[model samples]
Target: MAEISAVSEGPRTEGDDYRGIMRFAHLVRADLPEPALAVLDGSQAILVSTLYPDAPATLQELIAGGSAALDAVRAAIADGAAVVHELTDFTFASAVLAPPAVLAVGLNYAAHSSELGLKTDAAPTVFTLWPNSLTGHGQTTSWPRSLSESVDYEAELGVLIGTAAKDVSEEDALDHVWGYTVVNDITARDIQFAEAQWSRCKSFDGFTPTGPVVVTADEIADPQDLHIWTNVDGHMVQDASTNQMVRSVRTLIAHLSQSLTLLPGTLISTGSPGGAGYSRDPQIFLRDRSTVTVGIDGIGELTTHCRILG
Candidate 1:
């Protein structure tokens, strides 16, 4: 089993009340054909499928099921009907599996934009990360050494939508959010600069590592106030706040919904902050056996091991 950790949970509200924030993850073991969605209880997990026969099997299903499904799961927990599983018994799957899409915003932070010599366009610098790149915490991510020796690490905040929004107002934007998770938007710097677009360079297999757990949106007081940072091989590199984003989360959602509907289970990786390894005096890129951890305070942390295959 890979190392997994869960944040401390708070008091559960009364029956059928889904107001209380809950942490969720997708757990996998050899016996289970598919990943099982579980509610994190400290370091242990209670499989949501075991909570009720109709409960969702994956995080995507749960998001699509809406509030009624969440209420039922909470009701089951409050009833003490949960069957707990040890965290050590299974490794993690991506917090989000088969999301409708993985939308990524680039250069949302002025510092990051400045550091990379890119300008934050009047509209957000948005792109897509292929689903093939999505992996989970404590997983090993590898790429051919020939691809690039300049791969970089970016720590970002990831938001999951619970409802569809075609053209929502900024004020109503946050309501569509289901939860938040940490994302390490691993990038191949050389390919990224050489390419006309960002998709291919960053979409290599196992490049995007998301979640040990997803902390419900309600638990996060102000997305802008949280602390987000990165540590590469045990050394602090990137450190900043969501406050620095050129556009807020609600702004991004509202802006995105204008052109196309932001569907349920869609993950919006809200871009990274200032300290990219690329901008450091002596650029620090991920190497074989390197461990990189990206975290959002009170939200969650994700760790990815790196390998440069010949």
Candidate 2:
């Protein structure tokens, strides 16, 4: 794994003094065709490419460049390279616009498993989410009513791997993590229950929404301690801590690495906690025009608007 430099410890301020150590991605305009990597300093965003013309254009590129590339970005920030924009000036793209794969873990949270009448498996229930499903914060996600009306919301913590790993130990698994983000693992409950497989039901276009921003792993002291929650149509639907995972992030990474080489920029959506809409007493499914927001305490919140088309 690339060595992450120590970020200055202090309260983040506005203007130039802003901390540039934490990297995020956003589209400067809604019309912009691609996401640009930026250094988030307070309410401002400094475009990495703009600060240094030779800098990487996307997060994937930056990660591919390793620690030295990141160090260059930090150095540019510290030197006060003046081109900065207010965060409000741009809209967000998925924090992870592109990745090697989007791997989701299921039955990794006992509460979620028990509530859904499913048993915790001896091995992690893993599934792939198609790339077409990926969307950004504040974007509207729609599905046809004919697809089945039982669409549900799941608030999960997303983990991004910075380095490839093969047969890594749980004790050293976290070293490969690049950062963390929030994920709204939207699901078509009816399809999910009906099918023997999970990917298609959950991989519908726009079903997996991620990020307002991705915070580097160095910023997070303990992934297990973060508070994760979800709100749908203004009501708190799912609230839990990362501590509830049946398999810790470290355990999941290590376990996964045992089977295959986990590539850099791979996104792992750790299982959601209990309180999924599918398991609610009255059953709270996402309805037409509904809005949902999933958030983690330190990481930014991700919101998605829903449109149920006939």
Leading candidate by TM-score: 1
C-alpha local distance difference test of each model: 0.88, 0.84
lDDT score of residue 252 within candidate 2: 98
Candidate 1 per-residue lDDT over residues 50-136, each given as its tens digit? 877788998898889999988888778887555556555589888889999999999999999999999889999899999999999
Over 195-266, each residue of candidate 2 has an lDDT whose tens digit, in order, gives 999999898889998887788899899999999999999999888999999999999999999998999899
For model 2, the stretches where C-alpha displacement exceeds 4 angstroms are 1-15, 18-21, 28-31, 87-89
lDDT of 1 at 103: 98
Q: List the residue pairs that clash in candidate 1.
A: none
- For candidate 1, the TM-score is 0.94
Clashes of 2: 0
Q: Which stretches of candidate 1 lie over 4 Å from their true place?
A: 5-21
Error of 2 at 59 (Å): 0.7
* Candidate 2: pairs in clash: none
RMSD of each: 3.1, 5.5
Superposing every Cα of model 2 onto the true structure, what RMSD results? 5.5
Kindly report the root-mean-square deviation of model 1 from the true structure over all alpha carbons. Answer: 3.1
